[model samples]
Target chain A: MLLLQCPWCGDRSEEEFACGGEGDIVRPLVPEELDDRAWGDYVFMRRNEKGIHFERWRHAHGCGRWFNVARSTVTHEILASYQVGDDRPELPE
Target chain B: MSRARHEPLAHLALAAAGETTGPDAGVTLQAAPYQPAVILRGESGNAAFLEAFRAGMGFDLPLAANHVNSHAGATALWLGPSEWLVQSTTGQAEHGRLAAALTGHRHAIIDHGDGQQIIRVSGPRARDVLSKLCPLDLEGPDLAPGRCARSILARCSILLHPLPGGGYHIHVGRSFADYVWRLLADAGLEFGVAIGGAG
Candidate 1:
């Protein structure tokens, strides 16, 4: 089982958390300015990076806080974790 | 409001509780009597909030994550940075006191005892049975009374509290009560399980 360290609840198993697909997506201020493709892109596109990916996770069963996590898709290694409003940590090159 | 007499597991029979029964059973499971419980929410960073809470409740709000602090009849469990689960430590209703204390503060308090149950699991094998489904390392030196965490037990979300006397109190949703009890009973079969009634 994958162990996740919640920003508020500390380290816990993956079972107690829910993966919120992507993080930091901002909606267009003016929807009328966007075409169908642009709107579709905003709705459907995701980076799905090969290495480190930034995503949101909710401690569903634990403290019930949502936070950010940097993880390697290939290794399933969580590189860093921080609170929702906090800045992302500086990752190694 | 007067405390209502409602037990979710009242229908479960003790004879079917376990295969082994003795005073030395590894795990002794029972449904604890109902008590007043509430979920309190407020900004921990606000000094006014903290001061008001401490002055009114007679105890300081536990700021550390996963920490629990208690007074004579009330215990505050930190659920999040801004949230807590507070309940009566005695049989007396404590919610009224809670509601009265935070009267004008910018805070929120809601009853948590609605259809929720605290299953008491004690004995030498308490930790073992809990570890069967819980993911945390229960053997760490920091483990003590008032140490608690929210975790999954048999795939059901539960709030686990390890008491001072080596017993465990698991707060579970009413619907998942039977499943958790059966899972604990089944897991403790090899070690010996003793089922008792509410006290």
Candidate 2:
């Protein structure tokens, strides 16, 4: 089990967590404003990066809050877990 | 609202029966008989109400406050979303007073005195058992005291905290109390451990 540090609840277990997909995808404020292709792309498209990736997660079993996670896709080693509006995780040095 | 009639939890009582470690059996139940925690449950968008309730308590116990309360021999752990668990010393009468103060704050208070059983696990192998059940990593400086999180334990949702004594406190649902206890006991047996009342 990985120790996940929730920006709010501090560090909790992986068991109480649910992995959401890649993060930083901004949806259109109004659905009608976007074309069918844009809407589809926004909803379904994701980078799914292999190196450093940004993702969304919820403490489903714990606080039930959604947050963002940055980690290495190849190794699944979490670089950092922060609040949604907090700074995004950058590629490690 | 008037206080609900005090009714013993039949489910917990039944589960307590299968305990074999007690004086007469293989299980022991350290019943926390006092109505210690006055739980306040409500719908969303009540941040103002919650703030008011917090103010009324004369101390800030915000759900996400990250503040740890160290009382006489007890510890107060803050759980997720909008919950806080207040563990009391032997004769702390503050629970009732706090409950009375929080009434009519636009939240419903339920007596969780008998609703939960605080299970503590400690030892070098303590983290090993938790690693199998919880998804969070418990290693090095990551899982240290004053740190807490809400997560699933043994398929049931719970709040886990790394205590000052290098152990963990699993705050589970009243319904799943027995299931978690059994899981912990069975897991602990491999380490030549025993489960009984807290210090």
Candidate 3:
């Protein structure tokens, strides 16, 4: 079982959390200015990167805080976990 | 006019369930039914917020994650950066004072008096029983007295407060009280478990 460290509640079982998909997906400032293709890209497109990825995770069963996790998809190693408003960590080469 | 209110463990049939059996009945369970619980929210960085909480609750709000501050009549458990769970025997009075103190401040005081239940489990093997359902390492120093943590136990959300002597005071939604009780009981079967009256 995967153990995820919650920014507020500390390390807990992965069962206590809910993965919220890719992180840093900012909503467009001007929705009306975007074309259909751009809108579609924003709504459905994802990196799905096989290497290190930034994802959002919610501590659903614990403190209920949302945080960002930088993890390697291949190894499932959590590179770093940070608070939601913090900048994404610099990825390793 | 008066209304009838029922505690979460009212239907558990604890009294009729009979006493715990086995030679090593190492755990004792009791329902802390209807003890007042309040959820308070305010920016931790706000100096005014911290001062108001301290002035009203008679203690400083614990800024450290997973820490708890205890007073004569109440205890505050840090839930998040901006959230805390305050529990005390004087439910209505505590809520009233906090609400009045935090007035006009960017804060929220939610009275969870009847919305949740506290189950107290203590004894030599109390930690053993919790280990069965909780993924947390109960033996770790991080969970020592005056500390609390939020975790999943038996697939349900629980706020675990480790008591000074030993054992824990588990808080869960009112709806999940019975389920949690049964899970703990089953886990404590080998060590034996006793159900006691509400405190």
Question: How much is B54 displaced in model 1, in angstroms?
Answer: 0.9
How far off is each candidate at the interface, as Cα RMSD in Å? 0.9, 3.0, 1.2
Stretches of model 2 off by over 4 angstroms after superposition: A1-3, A9-13, B1-67, B70-76, B81-83, B86-152, B160-169, B190-199
Give the B-chain TM-score of model 1. Answer: 0.90
What tens-digit string does per-residue lDDT give for candidate 3 at A1-93? 677878776777898899999999999999999999999999999999999989999988777889999989999988889998998878777
lDDT (Cα, tens digit) per residue for candidate 3, span B53-123: 88877899999988999786888999888899988866544788888888878998898878888899997
Q: Can you give the lDDT of residue B65 in candidate 2?
A: 40
DockQ per model, Cα: 0.87, 0.46, 0.80
Find the 10 residues in a row with the least total lDDT in model 2 chain A: A7-16
Better of 1 and 2 by DockQ: 1
Cα error of candidate 1 at position B71, Å: 0.6
Worst 10 residues of 1 chain B by lDDT: B14-23
lDDT of 2 by residue, B109-142 (tens): 5566567655667656678778777666677554
In order of appearance, the predictions have TM-scores of 0.93, 0.63, 0.95
Ranking by TM-score: 3, 1, 2
RMSD of each: 2.3, 6.0, 1.6
Can you write out model 1's per-residue Cα lDDT over B131-198, one digit (the tens) per residue? 89888778874356767888888799888888887788999998889898889989998888887666
